[model samples]
Target chain A: MAKIKNLAELRKMREEQQKQLNLREKSNDPEKYVQIKVGMATSGIASGAKRIMDFLIVELDKRGIEAVVTQTGDMGYCYAEPTIEVTRPGEEPIVFGYVDTQRADEIIEKYIKNGELVEGIIPVNYESID
Target chain B: MAQQLKMQLLVCGGTGCRASESESIEAALARELKAHGLENEAKVITTGCFGFCEKGPIVKVHPDNTFYTQVTPADAREIVEEHVLKGRKVERLLYTDPENKEHVPDSRHMGFYRKQIRIALRNCGFINPENIDEYLARDGYEALGKCLAEMTPDAVIDIMKKSGLRGRGGGGFPTGLKWEITRKSVADQKYVVCNADEGDPGAFMDRSILEGDPHAILEAMAICGYAIGATKGLIYIRAEYPLAIKRLKIAIDQAMEYGLLGKNIFETGFDFDVELRYGAGAFVCGEETALIHSMEGSRGEPTFKPPFPSVEGYMGKPTNVNNVETFANVPIIINKGADWFASIGTERSKGTKVFALAGKINNVGLIEVPMGTTLREVIFEIGGGIKDGKEFKAVQTGGPSGGCLTQKHLDIPIEYETLVEAGSMMGSGGMIVMDEDDCMVSMAKFYLEFTVEESCGKCSPCRIGNKRLHEMLETVTEGKATMETLEKLKNLSNVIKDTSLCGLGQTAPNPVLSTLNNFWDEYLEHVEDHKCRAGACKSLMRYVIIPDNCVGCTACARNCPVNCISGERKQVHEIDQSTCIKCGTCMEKCKFNAIEIV
Candidate 1:
């Protein structure tokens, strides 16, 4: 830790440290950021969902995208094994099925950064009670 | 690196929650997280007061947003295993609504926090206070940086004046005006003082701010130093608040390390330093003059204010003193602009007030609500009404020096002028609610006892006057005062209020005066009727044995300490009222509901 020499240094240090608290800031208002929910139930974990979730978390930060990545219970898509739900601000959520680390990268690059639909799209087959 | 953290377990590390083993809860959560290998995925951070202290030690799981109340250290494993691993909420630990018996998921939906604005307490429960990085992440010293880099001294003061923030330390004096007064005062050495000696009985708002966001106070003080042209700052805090003192020391050290407090702060050639002066928890020291006197190693007694602390404060120099909560609001006002801070509260009073909500309230905690909020909304909606479904009675705002307001005053907006008009001043935001069982006379007596004990005795009106007032209240509660005594009590209270020197003596008689005005009939019952409706005054109560209900009931006679009950076997008993001590032991021992108090 260096002594803050001036206002510029203080402001720069604050910006660097602000990123450390970005997860908390994003969770406070999930709608303002890109929200990704990884299915982490037994079925999802059996298909290496943990690696994909970790990959998404690290890559999203590296790419300088404001996003919240959280784990959900079974999305009731056991057949897909590893699935993820991606919901942009004020939009319908899109679930991608059988997501390996490569597919997760593709989802981030195309669907998230470019706003383009990618392969392995799992459409909503059931309706919520609400 | 921040994105790696998937969840946050925010354990409340406030003094109240710490007393309830929140430290162990934090440790337990950490251990459980390690056991599950989720330490990296989930972070355990101990935050300051959530203000929901009744249900503490509170464990709030962030990102998922699960608020668990009254969480024991043993419940940590279940939280990590169920909530963290399986993404499921612990059902039993959730806060159940006292009304609907439904489990509240998070703090947002709960009635306790629903009405709160939380300006002063914004980063309190959210960020880790001890960690300076966390503070910096929340734009901690950005206000100081902005003020130094862009704004002039007058510009900063102008912004504060426009924000309309008054002193939260009971005076309600404009903070900007106080700074301006000190700025104008010509002195070789100027001082900026923070009055952290919060002596109100049920008040901990200052303590919470100091403990939770100490950096905010340092930042605000530096900003004040810049405004008032003071190089030296002193925090006059009470010795009783050990945790607050500890955190303040840490924050000052951190700020100094960052070159935010020491010489040449922000490399702008402005040198400012802050030091802490501990008081012996004297109530009079909360007054600015007395606080300065104490800081100067003199007796903590207030002198007349012809030359106010702004002109002649510590060592007879120009000084600007602000409360902890008042300083806590400064950085935000600077960051968000004056109009943003001014828009929330009432016409005269701006920004939210943090109150330590206590006494007969269902959710006894700390709350920050906007001005002009009705007492009814605070007590019923936010405070969760009176405890045990009891009928609402009078509420004593302020502390010993404040007045008690009754049911009719509930709808009045809680502004500075409004509270003073309703026979109570918002003295440091100690809102103590009373239930139907609480006798107003006894309540007044309780406050008088505090004033009598805490009085500095510098003035006869306060020292001798409060003593006499306490004795008079004693006689009234003991059912020994005549109508003449009541009249004398009223006159003496007025005299004390008029002749007292400082704010302490001036407001010492408020409890007595307010209760006398509001609950006159209850006081009259003690004097004339010799009856206490609430049965709080034991001297006014006469224990009588119901003739028809009693059947010999030697059980009561056997249990009576004074042997006041007399009866033959299988016959109705009579209670010897003169001999009875009113201990209620006979009443408890009566198997047949025989003993009754009249």
Candidate 2:
């Protein structure tokens, strides 16, 4: 690892580093890029959230899609262990459930790239606090 | 550059999960991946504590985001074969709702994570703690960078003030005010100290933050140093937290190597370095003044304020002391504007608080929620209600210095002021839920005993007054106390609270006062009726036989360990009140369920 010369160098390194990680931070500018959050709590990990997150990252990057996928702690949807919340440009975040590789592929290809909804959509049940 | 991998599996490497053999799970997953010749396609990463430690050894699969819980090393083979090879989620490892038989596949729908906001613990469970790049990728040091580059020390303090961030070290002091006081104090050499002693018995959110995201503390400390015009920082942590210590050392070394710390930071001529100091973990030493005294090689006992740590701290120089969780929130407050934080929590306490939810909780773990969130939301909604479907009795927060809150206070929003009004304080965010089985009087005694042990003895009111209070509660539990002793208990506890030297002694009687106020009827039952309705105080309960239910069962007579049951065979069993012990073995032995406690 090289010593970062300044904040710019550090920021540059972080931008590159973030690509390897599925960084799913919610951004104020929703139209910038697609953001995906995979539930990676204990249940998520035991059910194989790491694999799904990695697959989404690698496959999305491979497919030349602009997206940020990251690991989020339990979103309280433990019933949907392999769950991912996908938000495309200027759209609401939609949570999907029990996403096996087949579902992950369809989610990325249809929902992400072509802007179409697919199966395994886990409805958001919680009401936001004022 | 190489393309992204096809799949990834993340195993929880938290202390709880590691104790449950998550390491073996990680190794087994890697081996399985290698055996399948998919090592290049799939990756296995071990992250930090997921905060859901109740069901540990958690494994998460990426690409599809499958969450599996309570996974042992033995299940790794099937996880790899079925889940990894064929992309089928291993159904057995999934968390099945205890109430409902439905298997929960994602953590998002779980009751534990729904109401939680996770501000202080934002980066905790998600990333690998050891990797500096991972920390940086999450906009980690951007706060410090922004502080040094754009904002002046006063400007940074202004942002903190506007954010309304209070000290999460149980003090509830305004963080910005503490910084401003230290900044105004005249000193040549100043220091910024992070109090990570976290001596609360069941509290570990501080420990988790250190282990999960050590860089967060380091980054926040640097920002603090920058904000307070100090170049040296110290972390006063407990020796018991070896993992947190090791991770902090790694983060410091990495930051130093990356030019994030130690001289000419960001090429802005700003220099800051962080060092670690281990404490014996005296609960009283959590007080900032005492903590500073301990750091300075003086007596660990707390001294009077006005000369508070901000004015006279760390070798008698101006200093700033903040809790680990307090500092953990700094970087985020800087990165995102103060208003972003101020918008989340209540008007007074403008951010989320990380609570170590333990004791009689269905989902016992760390949860960070917005400050305005209610106790009902925490205990029932996020904690999955009381354990075993028992009725909730009370919750003890703020460690020994805090008081117990009853069911009537459940709906009240959990702000610092709100908790204080309810005869409880949110001390370091330790929420220990107690069920109906727990006795309020004994619960007060339990906290009093802890206070008696941890008292610095710097003052006599706490030393003598707390002892007397305990003796009264002790006598009450033994069913030997009169109503006069109960009055003495309340009076003595008030004296202790009023005259104690430090926060330790000042708030020592909170448990006794709070319990007596909340459960006065229970206390009356113990003193007047000589009965413990909860059956928690064993000496107050007696073992007897209901004559109607006793159908000449000799089993009670034979099983009585002390031969206290003297009735002959084919006759109603009678437990001799004088000689009988309250062991309840006769109750267990009686096939007719004749024996009962009267």
Candidate 3:
């Protein structure tokens, strides 16, 4: 580690560390960041949902996007194995079906980064009450 | 690929939780995470006190915010497997509300944390105190860097003055004014002192802050050093706080290596450094004058105030002394502007006050609540009410120097002036709640006994007056004092308060005076009827056997250590009143619920 020489140096170090050290901070207010939930039930896992979840987790950070990627039970879209729901800040959650690494990257680039929609959109048919 | 933390397991490393083996719990968590190959995915960080000490060791899972209480080392495996792996909360370990008996998974829903506003304790239970990087990540030394690079000495002092922060060490003096006074004093060698000598009984607020976030103190002291035009800073911490001392040393070394502490910090041509001065844990040394004296290798006794510490402190050089909690709040006030802090608390007392809540309370822990939070809210809402479904008798604030506040004073907002007006000073924020079972007369005697023991015998008023005060309390509790004795007790307490030289001697008689003012009826009963309603005064209590209820099993007679109970087997017993020792051992031995204290 280098010694902080000036205000600019300290600020630079803080800004760099803040990004890497923001997991706990992001968790505090998930709504402020991009929240992604992957289906991880038995049926979903049999269809390589684990690989897709890992791909999303690694790819999102590599792209310098702040996000909380958590796993949930089957979103009742067993027909579309490896389903994922993406909720951007102040936006409604959108479910994308048959999400592989390719589609996950497209979702990150088109949907998450630019707020543009891509194909394989699964419209909500049920109201999930909290 | 950079290691992305999906989850963080925050195990409480505060002194209270550590006593319950939180360190082993942290290791067990790390081990379980390693066994499952989820070590990098989920990080287990040993943070400072979570403040919910009643149910510890506490393991809080971040992102999901699942709060697990009373966790043992053995439960770590299940937490890593179930909570970490499967994203399932451990049902049994959740904090069950004392009112509804419903398990609350998150801390946000619990009554203990709902009303608290953590400012002084902002980084306490969050970051690893040993790592300066984590502290930096949370804008740790930004205040010092900002102060050195941008603001002038007077400019920084103006911010402190506008923030309305008082000295959290029970004196309620304006912190900025103290700094200004020291800055005005013409001394080539002025000093900034952080008073970490927290000697209040049952108070660990300062100790927790030091152990949890030592850098906060270091940074604040440097900021004070800059504001007061002082190059040297000393932390007068008690030697008993080994963990705090260790952490402070680590923080100091780390800050120096980072070029944040020693000389020419931030290349701003400002040099400020801090070192620790250990107190022998004398309660009187908590006072600034006594603390300065003790640091100077002299007697730990306070001197008269016209030449205050800010004027002629620490080798006759102007020295500024502030409490640990007061220093802890400085960085936050500087980071978030004065108005932001000034908006949280009451008019006179700004920012939050950290209190070590103990005694007969459901949640006995360290809590920081904003000023003007009522006693009812702290005792009932945040404290989870009295323990064992008992009625609250009185709440004692400010340690031995503070006074007891009864039920009538519950609704008053807890500002410094309000507490003092209600016959109690906020002396280091030790709030001990007393339940119905605690006797008021005996409670006053208990505090008097502590004062008698801790009173630095520098003045005759404190040395002799407090000793005589304790004797009068003894006489009252023993049921031998008349009404004339009570009058003398009140008169002597006032004399001690008026004639004493220092704050310790001045406030030593508060408990006696306050209890006498609040529970005069209880005192009358002890003196006139020769009976203690609470049964706390043993001498005033008599053990009598209920004739009808006695089974005559000879248990009481056989177990009586002094042979006070005499009866043959299969016959009712009779207690010899003259020979009874009031030990109440026979009461425990009775099987038929025969013996009762009258």
Candidate 4:
């Protein structure tokens, strides 16, 4: 990382970086990667979603799990907060609610690594556009 | 390579559910799964608010999207045994509609959420806000990327000006015009600011957005920086919002790491980064000038404005400031074109407004409805009418700074212009529904008291006018005021509104003026007849025990804290007016309906 001198050099460097980013994104199948989606919606944030999301990302890497993590807005379930939605290849995405750091660690070890369902599995009994 | 599968459980983590012990419910479900040796089989997650807040704590099992409402710790064992173990939906905990008693399996199909168009609250309960990648998946920075890649600084301002999206934080000022003013201003350094200092009582619309979607504000500010050619953004949030502040910090840090913020954003040569500045719980700081002053480490006070924040603000540089709710709507407007954003709201006021629907309303939560949605629809259809089947009297919009609108104004469309025309301004969209039991005279006094305390005392109008107004209200409510005092109140209110320096002093007289206009008869009755119709004014009200209805039940006598009630075994109880202290305990305790407020 070098200090950006002026706007022109900054634009050139950005263009090069964007090209690399596009190439990487194009080469890899986004859906194929183990997608870990956390609910950071207003209700979710009120319920401490940031802490759980932070815990999961750091812990997942520490545990040597190769996964792609991201955030989305409200899933409409404002009651159960700090919700995380995890999807593996060729399987339906599952949503877990009321996740803390302890639960995030368990989710990474059991659900992400061992392919097992952990506690706090909130069954989606409704139709959602997402 | 061995592929591993994962499960996601989305729980409604809104404040409504959290108060119902949703945290405990989450813990119990986890414990139960671990105990049953199925901990490896499931993963529990918490998400942002599910809209239906009444039947919370709501648990939704994803992939299947099984919606469970009113889940308790006691029901966790059964949920694990029945749902997780046997792969069957728990029949008991599922949400049953109150109208027809039919089980609603999906939240989308629920009658409550069928009409809602969730744009501001798009990523609230779905993605983890702490992760920048999840924001990326939802096309978060694509707008910023588009703005930087193709559009120039002036062009971005032009698009926003055409969008017609006004500020949602009380005053409906055009957001683009503010940006344009800031962009055109000559300054060596410029700044972008987010006003998360929401101080309106019972208003949590800003709080919910910050908690659920902090990334949106970050993204919007970054885009604003690119448009205004600023490299830094500051979010001045109240220290009271711990969850919101924490999430905002996390989101900012994560954005910096992902190259969404800091230096070049999305490889578009836009270097914008946001920092958090917490307020020490001052109500007046909600005003932009006051907010800028506070950020400059001065006491939160409003200054005389010829040069607004857009011209000269925040360390005396050209700054653009919008509240949390206003910034929340920016991303959607840019992503889905200006016309699409302009189409939903009223002719003048564009896009939806998020209201903290509270006070006697059934749906006591955060609701975002398009501007021009009638108060009747919001109160009756959406809010499910008043609690305990009470007659609707008035709906107070805009907190202490707004006027109280009666049932006559219910059909008037709720836009900035219409609301102001109806003797009320949409001050941050805090609609507090009041029933017939609420006394208008007393309500006016209550809001006046709030304004008097929150006044910055910089000017004479707010400081002196609020005191005089409060004294007059007190006199009227105490049955001591005359018609002459009423005239004084009217004259004083007008002077205050006209002479005030800032919005706080200007709108301080709204409650007094609006109440006097709508509930003039109520005030006259209190002064002329010396009677409080609602029995709310303690000085004017008296508790009388009726002999016919009294069965000599000693309940009222025993419950009276001041020992005001006296009666024989078989006769009626009498409340001694002198000793009563007007506590109304005897009135509440009389089971035989003996006691009445006169």
Of the candidates numbered 2 and 3, which has the greater lDDT value?
A: 3
> What does the lDDT read for residue A34 in candidate 4?
70
Model 3, residue pairs in steric clash: none
Predicted candidate 2 versus true structure: per-residue lDDT over B202-272, tens digit per residue: 89989999998899999998888988889999999999888889888988999999999999999899999
> DockQ (Cα-based) per candidate?
0.56, 0.21, 0.52, 0.03
Reference interface contacts recovered per candidate:
0.56, 0.38, 0.44, 0.00
TM-score of each: 0.97, 0.87, 0.95, 0.79
In TM-score terms, candidate 1 sits at 0.97
Compose the digit string of candidate 4's lDDT tens values, residues B1-598. 1211123566666666777988888898889888977675465666667666666788876544568988888988987776665445688888776667877765666655555566787777666565555565566666776777777888887878887888889998998998988898988899999998898888888888887788899989988998887899999999988878888888887777666788866565667889999899888999999999999999999998978888899999999998888888777777788889878888888888888788887777667788888898888877777888889999999999999999899999889999999999999978898888888999999999998999989999999889989999999998999999999999999999999989998998999899999999999999999888887898988889888999997998888898888888887778888777888788777788887877
Please state the error at residue B329 of candidate 3 in Å: 1.2
lDDT of 2 by residue, A7-80 (tens): 78878988888875653332212247887878877788789787787788778877988775655667788887
Best by TM-score: 1
Candidate 4 overall lDDT versus native: 0.79
TM-score, candidate 1, chain B alone: 0.98
List candidate 1 stretches off by more than 4 Å: A113-130, B1-3
| Interface RMSD per candidate (angstroms) | 2.5, 7.4, 2.3, 12.7
Model 3, B1-598: lDDT tens digits are 3445678889998888888999999999999999988887899898888889889889888876789999999999898877777666788999998777888978878888889999989888888899888898999789988898889999999999999999999989999899999999998999999999998889999999998999999999999999998999999998988888998999999999999999889888899999899999999999889999999999998999989889899999999999999999999999999999899889888989999999999899989999999999999989988999999999999999999999999999999999999999888999999998899999888888888898889899999999998999899898899999999999999999999999898999999899989999999999999888888898989999999999899998888888878988888999998899988899998878988889
Q: Please give the interface root mean square deviation for model 1, in Å.
A: 2.5
Q: Chain A only: give the TM-score of model 1.
A: 0.93
Count of clashing residue pairs in every prediction: 0, 57, 0, 83
